[model samples]
Target chain A: MVYYISFILIGIGIYGILTQKNLFKFLVSLTIIDTAINIFIISLGYIEGKDVPIYSKYTPVANFVDPLPQALVLTAIVIGVGTLALGASLLVRVYEKYETLEVEEIAVKEARK
Target chain B: MTIATIFVGILMIISAIYAIEAKKMLDSFISLSLLSLLSVFLFVIMKAPDVAITEASVGAGLTTAVLILALRRIGGDEE
Candidate 1:
């Protein structure tokens, strides 16, 4: 079920990226895709009736969820943020130069110049 | 628990769609934040507390800030 949801989100993100003319919407779509992938990765490690990987005196150690996917997702989240920041900065730069956020307008301007 | 997880997942999809389809950039950003918040909830339900905290802080918090700042810099929703 979670997998299905994530796949649908990925589809939506791709649709947005392909159809939207605004540069900022493109970045938003990228963020959506990043988030869906992260969710899908974390869900891969989930087991029904299992506890989190955190250890405590009362909790049994054997029934904890798989920690590997969590670790990978942690790294992915950080990288997603970094990329989002970079994309946002690039959007700002593009807007500064083109005076518009529409991708088609930017292309036309570039062609004339 | 499964029911709750499914419910949140559905909400996440709805918000993701709204974020993509929203007319104004500000509305889209708000929907994006809502999607992030729902994902954090879903993370907690899936027995991934660490990822939930990280997402709540970084994904929901920092990402929204960065996008809003960029929107402001671009002079907001000219269309």
Candidate 2:
């Protein structure tokens, strides 16, 4: 069920990336795509009847959930934020110079220059 | 519960669609945050607390800040 939903979200994000004209919308779509991939990774490592991977006094290592995906996702989330900030800053610069957020407009303006 | 997971999944799908399909830049931006929040809930349900915390703080908060700052600079015009 989770995989199905994640695939659907991935498809939606890809569609948005292909069709959206606004620069901000493109960034939003890319974020959505990254999120779907994150969910997919987290779901893949789920084990039935196991507790979270955090160590505890009584918790047996064998009963703990897989921790690798969680660690990867932690880094991925930080990278996602960093990339988002970088993209937004670039968009700000583009908007200042081109005076528009529409992708086609930016391309056309650049083509004419 | 499975029901709650399914519910959050549905919310994620809806939020994703809204974020991409909305007419205005602000609408899409706000919906993107909603999508991120829903994903956080989904992560909690899927037994990934660390990912949920990271997503909640970084995904929902910082991502929105970056987008909004850019939107303000760009004047939030989608056309």
Candidate 3:
């Protein structure tokens, strides 16, 4: 079920990437894809009836969920943020260069040059 | 727990679609933030408190700020 949701989100993001004309919308789509991938990765480690990976005196050690995916997702979240910041900065530069955020307008401006 | 997970997943999908389709750029931006918040809730429902915290702080908070700043810099007039 979670897998299906992520897949749908990925599809939506791709659709947005392909169809949206605005540069900012393009970045938003990319962010959506990043988030969906993170959800999918985290879902990979989930078990139906397991405790969180944290250990405590009362919790059995063997009952903990997989910790590796959580660790990987921590890195992924940071990377996603970095990617978003980079993309946003690039979009700002693109707007400055092209004088517009619309993809069609930018392409036409490029062709005239 | 399974039911709650499914519910949040559905909401996330809705917000993602709205984020893509909204006419106003700010509306799309808010929808994207809502999607991040729902993901945080879903993370908690999955029993991953640490991931939830990270996502809440970084994904929902920082990402929104970045997007807003970028939007402001670019001017929010969408045609």
**Top TM-score: which candidate number?**
1
Regions more than 4 Å wrong, model 2: A57-61, B76-79
Off by more than 4 A, model 3: none
Write the residue-wise lDDT of candidate 3 on B8-43 in tens digits.
Answer: 888998999999999988889889999989998878
i-RMS of candidate 2: 0.9
Q: Is candidate 1 or candidate 2 better by TM-score?
A: 1
Candidate 1 per-residue lDDT over residues B2-34, each given as its tens digit = 688789888988999999999999999999999
C-alpha RMSD for every candidate: 1.1, 1.5, 1.3
From the highest DockQ down, the ranking of the candidates is 1, 2, 3
TM-score of chain B of each: 0.93, 0.90, 0.89
Ranking by lDDT: 1, 3, 2
Which clashing pairs does model 2 show?
Answer: none
Of candidate 3 chain B, the 10-residue stretch with the lowest lDDT total is B70-79
lDDT of 3: 0.88
Candidate by candidate, in order, the iRMS in Å equals 0.8, 0.9, 1.0
Tens-place lDDT per residue, model 3, A1-113, is 88998899999999999999988888899999988988888889988888888878868567977889989898889888998999999988998898898889999999999
Q: Write the per-residue lDDT of candidate 2 for residues A9-94, one digit (tens) a residue.
A: 99999999999888788899999999999999999988878888887776755577789999998998999898889999998898
TM-score against native, each model = 0.96, 0.94, 0.95
The candidate 3 chain A region of ten consecutive residues with least summed lDDT is: A57-66
Output the better candidate (1/2) by lDDT.
1
